[model samples]
Target: MFDILVIGSINADLVFISDIRPKAGETVMGKDFKVLPGGKGANQAIAAARLGKKVGFIGCVGNDDNGKKLIENLRGNNVETQYIQIVDDVPTGVANIVVAEEDNSIIVIPGANYSISKDMIDKNMDILLNSKLILLQNEIPMEVIEHIIDLCFGKDIKVILNPAPAVKLKESIVNKIDYLTPNEHECKIAFGNPNTDGLLTKYPNKLIVTVGDKGVLYHDGNKKVNIPAFKVDVVDTTGAGDSFNGAFAVAIVEGNSLYESLLFANKAAAISVTKIGAQEGMPYLEDLKGL
Candidate 1:
């Protein structure tokens, strides 16, 4: 059985480096362009796999060269991609990433990712129910996420969701997630009311709020605390959060204390930002040992 199961979109990322983001209707010559195998789900899967988790991926890719390469890349990282379905109708997902100095902006074309049906989630429900942990991101259809959450109910498995690219999930599903990781923007988007607001207060289980640079905030019932980020010279920080979430799951599954897991995750993410590419920048166990 997989230690962790991930269900979300899959894509190849086209990353470009520019002195600054080009203004709308203005074209600036980019300094460099680099292509990398990435997708929020793919990145997280590799992140966890690199941290020694038996991670299985459930998503779709195109039947084209990109799809074949995408599967090969995941397998190269030891992330199980046998369940990655290839469809001819829609091309593989693609993320157009532009790095403006230290910051970056992205525009994604879901392609085959959008066709990952609810039925697929139902069929793979067993994988998630049996997993020690399941990581989720908003790259897939909401129904897919909902089905997985519903099926994992009362099971031994834990669900760790990073509500990225920010979308509010159905309240019922929110109540079911074992853990929720939302960045500052996502945190604000999940809750609008100041009285009964705060994603932590709304959820019955664990919730973690990640603030870039300032660090992460972990809240479980009456307990809440902050975990500071490791100091590093950041380059392109596209997949730092994905790395952190994946590493967090690995540390937790390995029986590390929550604080320790988060600290380790923080370091892993810090290391990721210092380099370029998503999975390419991800550090291995020995690399973290040096930190």
Candidate 2:
């Protein structure tokens, strides 16, 4: 059985590195460009797998070179890809990223990611139900996510929802999640404002909000714990959150307490930002020993 199953998008990231972002209808010279395998789902899966977790990925890609490369990359990282499907006549998902001064702006073309339908999920129910935990992101269809959430509700399997590229979700759905990890900006999108005071009151220990560089804040039933981010010189912040989520899932599955898991995840995220690319920057378990 897999320790964690990630149900979301898989995309090829085309990144351009530059000193500054260009204005509307303007162009700028970029220092370099690189194509990397990334998708919140794939990145997290690879991150967990690299950290030695038995992770499985569930998503859709096109029957093309990019799709093959993405699957090969996942397999290379030790993530189980039996659940990843290839759609006909569609291109694999792609994200055009511009990294400037260690920050990034992205425009994603959903492509085959949108083709991960309910039928696919239903067909993979055995895989989904057998996993210890499910990791989800907003990169896939909301309905598919909701259906999966409903499937996990009141079941033995726990659910960790990362509300990225944020969208408003129902209270019923939110209440069903065991953990909700959202960044500062995404927290704002979920609650109509960036403030988490009300969210903490509502979700209590279920809410985790990641503040870039500042660390993470979460309510732990009795009190709030703020895990400080590890100090590091950041080279690129693209996959920092994905690293955190993947590590957090692994830590939790390994029976680490909330605070301990948060600390581990914080360290992993800190390490990821110190390197240049998204998946390229993700740290292995050995790298976490001294951190």
Regions of candidate 1 where Cα sits further than 4 Å from its true position: 193-198, 201-205, 220-223
By summed lDDT, the worst window of 10 consecutive residues in model 2 runs over 193-202
| TM of each candidate vs. truth | 0.94, 0.98
lDDT of each: 0.84, 0.91
Error of 1 at 10 (Å): 1.1
Q: Write the per-residue lDDT of candidate 1 for residues 1-291, one digit (tens) a residue.
A: 999888887899999998989888998998989989999999999999998889999999999999999999999999998888899878999999998879889999999998898888777766767789889898888777787888887878888888988876566777787778888778667654333235556463377777789888875566567788887888989999989999998988898877788899988898899888887888788778766
Candidate 2 on 1-291: residue-level lDDT in tens? 899999998999999999999999999998999999999999899888989989998999999999999999999999999889999999999999999976999998999999998899999999999999999999999999999999989989989999988988788989999899999889888767656876876788788999888899988777777888899888999999999999999999999998899999999999999888789989998998877
